[model samples]
Structures are given as C-alpha cells and as structure tokens.
Target: MVVSARITNFLAYSSLTVSRVSHLGNGSLRYQWLLCRNTSLLQLRSKIQTVVPSITSNVSVPKENIPTADALVRPDLEGLYEDIREGLTNTQPELRQIAQYYFNGEGKAIRPVITMCMARAINYHLDQNAPGVIQKQKKIAQIAEMIHTASLVHDDVIDVADSRRSRPSVNILWGQKKSIIAGDFILAMASGMLARLQNQQVIILLSQVLADLVQGEFMQLGARENKDERFAHYSEKTFKKTASLIAYSCQAVSVLSGADSTLQSIAFQYGRQLGMAFQLVDDLLDFIATSAQVGKPVAADLRLGLATAPVLFAAQKFSELNPLIMRRFQEPGDAETAFRLVLRSDGLQRTKELARQYCNDAVTQVAQLTPSPYQQALVTLAHQLLHRMK
Candidate 1:
C-alpha cells in the first residue's frame, strides 16, 4: 500500500504537468487556477519558508554521524573503473574505445557511488552488525555507471554536443553514426552484465531504465506551448531521463539485498528525489556556470531550444519568454534574450530552492534507515550535491 501511494505521488506530479492545455486567455479565473495548480513560484516561496523547517526538524540524524563525501566514492572508485573496463573487453577494439571513452576516471561517477552506498547501507539496515557490500551489489553499481555513460553518449548525438567532461564527446570523435552505435554497444554490454546477475526481478527493474531514457529523449524533442503545462512537462522529462535510472537502480539493489517491499520503496523514493535534484542542479549550472567550469558549453539547453527548470521558473515573471519557449528560441537572439530574462528574474534562485527541497526530501527518506556510516554518507552526499560546481 505504501509502495502504491509513493508511486502514485510520483506519477501524479507528472500527470498534472502534462495535462491538456487550456486555451483561455491570461486573466481568466480558470487560467489562473491552471497556472497556480502546479504550485506557482509564489506558492513555492511560501512553502519553502514553512516546509523546509518542518522537514529539517524530522531529520534526526546528526551531522557528526554522517561520513565525508570523499569517503562515499573512494573505496570502490578504482575497482569500479577496472570492472567497467573489464566488461568492455569482449567488444571490438574501436567499439570498446568509444564505449569506454568517458570512463577515464575524471568525472565523478555519482550514480554507482550512490548505488553502492545504498547497497551497503541497506545491507547494514537489514543486519546492523553485517555492514559490507556484497558481490552482486557491486555489479549493480557497475551496471549503473555503464547505463549512465551510454546515455551520455547518445545524448551528445541527440544534442549535437561536441564536448563533455572537458573533452571531445564521443559523437565528435567518432561521428554521430558510430557514436550512436557505441552507445548501443555499451547498453548491450550492460544488458549482458545484468543478465549474469540472474535476478529476474532486478533485471526487469533495471530494464525499465532503458525505456525511460528513450521516452525522456522524445519529451525533450518537443515543447509545451501552454505555460501552465510546461513546468510539469519539464518535470516529467527530468524524471524519465535522469531520475528513473537512479530510482530503479537503487530499487534493484534493494531487491537484490532481500529488502521488504517497504524498504525497497524507500530506496526508490530516495533515488527518485535525489535524481530530480541532481538534474535540477545540472539545469541551473547550464545557466550560471562557465563552459570551463561545467566542462560543457553554457546555455546548452537554451541553444537546443529546450526550456529547463530555470527557464520555466523565469517564464512566470517574463511573458516575453512565452513565445520564445513556444517557438523553442529559434529566432535570432531568442536564446540570448531568454537567457538574459532568466538571469534578471528569480528563475535561477527558485530553481535552486526547488532542488534543495528535493535534496532535503532525499535525505529525509534515507534517514528512515538504521543509522550507519553508509547511511550517513548517503545523507551527506545529498547535501553536498547542492554545492557541486560541475
């Protein structure tokens, strides 16, 4: 029942966002209702002031109990890359290089680290005295990273992005066709690795991530003309593309660890919330960070004609953005004008505030577990995500 409720809450938000676009003009009561229904920025501001304190009050875990961010990824950092490389060894040399290109130990492997952290923490939660990560759990971590990297490769092709992580993208080096093949190849290898896990339930759970990735890309290719519906559209896309993998990956590990349905739901909820927050931060970084800082071009979303959280939030204050969003900033200076408007408005700050809520919610969900270093690391990591520059 709890699982059903959580899943419903997750989908309800999506449904609200993608609802039919009302044709009523701006000043009508019905129009106002639709606009405010998804919690307008004004409402969010009030909620943030009141809700954050209440939420933080529920977090009983102490600061001293949490582990450092370094402690979270350091243990498995070296072995994770090696294992991922080993997974790629059976493929052809060129495919192997393209598939393994982004695994160069530079970027922070946040997904796998979160997976392993959840695995160990859940392991400890189930057995307070037995707090070690099992072999199968490690495989899940590797699979998560592989799936993530594969998505990045495909995304670069779709976005026609030339750079990633301060290096030339796979699409740039290998061309779009081979870059796509490379992405597919990495996914195939990850699938094979998943099959060896031999857990039908876990396999099904992780497999859904592949479908979500495709669905998200489809959502990105289109735009919502209705201002009321755009934020919901963005949220849904963010979940399908970014959050589903983390949510399902965390849930898969929970299933592997023999967690009860309730515990598994908690893991999924944590990952769902954290994944949304992570992407929100990424969207914010696109607006505020430099090309060198984020290792990718700034304003990439705007250039791609996509309206992310920041742009969506900024739209509320600037009606000029409505047509720009509808047409996807295709006009000369549309992207530039929209970018300036977003900065002038409170979009960046509101986006940050919303992300902080999701991050706090992640911390709250993980705090339900039995207190342990691994659990504490998960909590600490959630907080640290807000401050990340890249």
Candidate 2:
C-alpha cells in the first residue's frame, strides 16, 4: 500500500488553485493560469521520477508524504468494491486487462463509488435482512462501471483520441479495430451480468442506456459538418450519451432495492441532473484543466468535431467562431485557437452556472431523505460533481 505522491500533489495543487480562483481579481486570470501550469509541471516531473526513478537521481521525495489509494476511495464501499473487482477480473480476462490498465493507472473510480454509496443509503433505510443484498448491489455497480469503460474505449476510437488518463489510449496501443472489439466485448459481458439479475426493469433500463449511448455517438458524427447547428445537437447528445446512464443507474438501484416508484423517480431525476452537471463541468475542464491534470489534450472535444457545452455556449456569442470550430482538429494549431476562443468567451461562466443549477436540483432531490450520513454524503457528492477540477 503506498499510493503515488504525484497523485497526492496533483490533488493538493488542483484543490488549492480551484479554491483561490474564486477570490481572484478580474485581471488575475493569467496569473492563475501560470500558477496552474507551474503546479502541473511539478506534478509531471514527479510522475516521471516515479515511473523512471533511476533516470532522475536529482529528484528526491519523502516517502511518508505519499497518499494511499484507500484515501481516495470511500471506506464504506471497500467490501463492495472488492467483490466487484474480483468479478470483473475473474469473468472476463481481456476486458479486465484493459480495465486494469486504465483503473490501476489513473481515475478515482468516483462513479461506482457513488453508486455504492446510494445503494448503501437505501440498504440502511430499509430491508435490514434482505438476503444477498450486498452481492446484488456490488454486481450492479460493477456492471455499470463496465458499461462506462466500454463507452470510453469506443469514444476514443470514434474521436481518434491518442491519449486518455495521461497515457496512450487503447486504440493507440492495440489499434482501432482491437479497441473497438474490446469495447464490444465488454458491452456484451456487461449485458450478461445484467441478465443475471433476472430483473426485467433493470435490463430494460440498461438496454435503453446502451441505445442512448449509440444514438449520441451517431448524432455527434452526423453534426460534424454543420457548425451553426452543432449546439442543439450536441446538447441533446450529451443528455442521451452521458446523463442517461447516470439517471438509470440511480433508478436501477432504487428498483433493485424495492423502493417505491416515487423514490425511484426521484433518484433517477437526481442522477440525471447530476450527470448533466458532470458533463458540463467536464466540458469546462477541457478548457481550464491542464493537460496533465485532465489526462487529455485541451479542447479535445472541439478537435473531434464534438461540440461540448462550453463550446456551444461560446458559439452563441461569436457566430464567426463556428466555421473555425467545425474544421477537423487534425491541424496543429486548430486546438489552440479553439481553446483561446472558449477561454475568452462568456460560455465558460454560463456553462458553470448551468452546472450549478443542476447541482442545486440534485441536492433538492435528495433532501427528502431523512437526515443520515449517507444522505449528507450524497448531497456533498452532488456538490463535488459540480466543483471538481478533474
């Protein structure tokens, strides 16, 4: 157990800068960017030293200062995660290998963690003696994560993305065809897991989520040539592509736990709002977060001809910017210009406001739950989704 110090520093620096940004004066944006850039460089240097220790004898770090993976993961979900990880690794070795490549290397596993938290919240409130409840919850969480990972794999292929989680993408490592096959394999495996639940409602919800994911991809692909119309299409796509899974995840848990229809609807709404907020924030991070922090090139969405929320908002103010954004991002300088335009536009602020509104709605949805630590954690999770830097 010891975790990497680089991750600890990234979290520390990112948190500090995000907090300081709120108090910054109007003219201090450049200064803030410099601060972020310098911190990111330091973080990168630290990572290089860790990955290739002998190559950099000049770099020395304190062992005790490093944080553990356990610190990032919620302790309440540890047992559940153990089961999920075991199942994933044992059942589908190839998918597990790819998943391990991504999971062990980066990502906070925040989504499944949230799913487990919601499940535990329900379990705490009702069904004190529900047999096999923990097993079912863990399986659901794992299946959800598998579907998510599969989507990312396919997304990288579709976007022609070279990097993910600060490393070369699976498509880059193994080739696009293999990457696509791997994604499809994971999707099939995930479906099998869902079928085991023998719950028709869960199966239907997840099947619809898969369909929405595909529809979103197609929508983005079709809208590539039309810049002026990209915003509406992109917004609708984000709702289907990103928000639907999250919404259904909440609904799935509620149904599995035998909660009333009203509670299930509330949970679904909470997740939908939170997922929209999450994607909006993700779009903002593409412009604001550093390459090292975000684990992808800045403005990657724009480069891929996929208009994200911030870019859509920015396009509203500068109609002339649409042509520039529609151009395939294959050119060397296109991404930089897109980045600067987004930064200078009011879209960033507007997108943040929209995300905050959704976060507020998420909090309201969960407010009806009786006061408990898990309920408070859900509210905090919603806020975290809105405010997280990466």
Candidate 3:
C-alpha cells in the first residue's frame, strides 16, 4: 500500500508501473483495487489534480491487471489467527474484555501469533513427543498479548485517542482515570503471569522490556521537535515500543522450553526485526490506510503531533514540513498538505525499503533454525508481516 508520488506519476503517465506493482498482501491489493475502481482514471486524476493541482491529465488501468483476494490469504495464517483468538478468549474475564475491545478489534495480533508460531517451530524441532508444549506456547502467547494490550490501554490515554478499532477507546468508554488504572492492572496481571512461570530469565526479560517501552515513549515525546535528530530516535522508540516485547515473547518461549542459547537468540532477533517492520508498516498505514481499514483515522499520528518514520523521512526532503510537524500539525489543513507532500516525495518508498530490510533480517534470523513445517510457517509469517495492510 506504500506508494510514492513517483509511482503515482508513473502510473498516471504510463501503464508501466501497474504491471510492476507487487502484491504484498491480499488485503492491500484488494483495497487498492477498491480505491482504483471506485474512482475512474479521470476521477482519480481529478482528485490528484485537486491535491497537487499540477497534474493535468488522466491515465488508464486495465480491469484484468488487478490481483484478487484469493491470492493473498495463505492457509497457514488462518490457523495462527484462530489460535490467537482462542488464547485471548480463554484468559480472565477482565483481561478478556480488554483483549476483546482492544486486541481483537484494533490489532491484527501479528506479534503474539508470530511468537506462538516461532515457539511451535522450535518446539516441534526439539521433541515431537513433548508434553504440555502447546499449552505452554499458548500461555506465552497470551502473556505477550497481555503486555501489548496493557500498552495499548496506556497508549490510548497517552495519545488521548477517542476511538480505536472503530469503537470508543478504553479511555473514552471508562474515563481517563479508569483507563490508566486498567492499563496498570493489565501490566500487573502480565507481571504476575510471568512471575508464576518462576523463570528468572523470562521475568527479567519482560521487566526490561517494560522499562524499554516506557523509555521509548518518553524519548519519542522528548524528541518530537527535533527533526534533525538521528533516525535512531525513531529506531529506538520502535525497538522499545514495538520490537522488544515481540523479541522477548519469542525468546521467553525458547527459555521456558529449554532451547539452546543460539536458537533462543535467533528467535529474539527474528522477533526484534519483525516488530520493527510491523511498526514501520503501521506508520505507513497511518498515512495511506482508510479509517475503516486501519481502525483509526488516517493521519492520526500526525494529527496527534507524533512524527513517525514516514513523516521523519518526508521532513528530510521538505524542510518546510518541520514547523508543521513540530507544531503538531496545529495549522489548519497542515496534516492534509503534509500527507500529500510525503506521498509525493520519496519518503514513502524509503520507509517501505526500511521495513523490507527489517523483514529480510527477520527471515535471515529465522532461517538459521533447522527446516521444518513450523520453520516454514515462521518464515511465511515473517513475509506476511511486511506485507500486511491492516
């Protein structure tokens, strides 16, 4: 779904890029067709002209060129999706409510599903006859999700988001004070769940992850105005806010199941890369995805004064975009203009490339593990992560 002005221009001026367009996921391709179909080439050109005002003409699109939905949904992800849903449902009632409201609705549950898949990958490799492996893996998956859910509750309060997953946010439904308490409650529950495992290593790992998560959020808030700051701030925030939990989630299962250090490290690295890629794609989607598709308003991050990877990348090219970004898109119509400028620039492409790199790194890390159906599933999951539209 990541497209640059260059690509749009290419599509407008010539039919060449249409054929070269890659299908990352079925949802995105389907969405693309929906957008392209709802507006004819002439109408699309007109819209583009309204925004850019410089583009003068329309382009043609062959009806048969668009890919179908059947091509995108690999059978493997279906089971992972089911397992995640089941895991969330089986948790405590309050936790389950939180999961149902936030996790089930807003998120794709990519991280926890990947955690379970990777754990199963290593588990199946170690001992096919092992007892309780599935149960253990499921519990680990739940814990990962709990951490994520807890963060989201807090995030809604922090961001002052009114809606999530197309519904009233936890803060909106239960007030900010209760929302903060609920977030802390989930964190406490997650901590207790990890403590019950009594694995010093896993407990330490998750504890550090919580710290990193807070630090990342703090850093992001502090660096909101510094457009010239190294992309490392974004990178670090991504790690703490997104990657660390995923990395630990996978690694914890390895330690719980007594995998070798090398395998455990590989799992952690795989999760880290995948998590970073997930956040990058999320940032990309904020600009490109619709309110319905993304489960939140388009450009919500920019509207909230948060500068993500795409905005950061775009700011590098359009220096004038900084004041708008720094001022939290305070000016009237600033977000719309900023969005158009980024779409027109190389920022989207750069962001996609960065996400692709992380996906590649994740694939490489998981490739180190011995080949099995589960390993293949993990690899497929990694590929699926980069291409996800919603």
Top-down TM-score ranking: 1, 2, 3
What lDDT score belongs to each candidate, Candidate 1 first?
Answer: 0.73, 0.62, 0.63
Q: List the residue pairs that clash in candidate 3.
A: none
Q: For residues 1-390, what per-residue lDDT tens digits would candidate 2 score against the true structure?
A: 122343234233222211110000000011223334434433433433233212112222223333322342355446544544554575456666664455442456666676766676666666433657666766777777777778888877776666676567887788878788778877887898899999999899989889988887776667664554454455567777778877888788878888888878877877787787787777766656655665555444654555566666667666756776666544655545555566567666666665666666777777766655666677777755654655
Candidate 1 residues 169-260, lDDT tens each? 78878898999999898899999999998999999999998988888778778766488777766767778888888889899989888899
lDDT of 3 by residue, 300-343 (tens): 56656667777767777778888887677767667667776676
Residue pairs with backbone atoms closer than 3 Å in model 2 (clashes): none
Q: Is candidate 1 or candidate 2 better by TM-score?
A: 1
**Residue 228, model 1, lDDT:** 74
> lDDT for model 2, on a 0 to 1 scale?
0.62
Candidates ranked by lDDT: 1, 3, 2
TM-score of each: 0.82, 0.74, 0.74
Worst ten-residue run, lDDT, model 1? 21-30
Model 2 alpha-carbon miss at residue 341, Å: 3.6
Question: In each prediction, how many residue pairs overlap at the backbone (N, C-alpha, C within less than 3 A)?
Answer: 1, 0, 0
Superpose all Cα atoms of candidate 2 onto the true structure and report the RMSD in Å to 1 decimal. 11.9
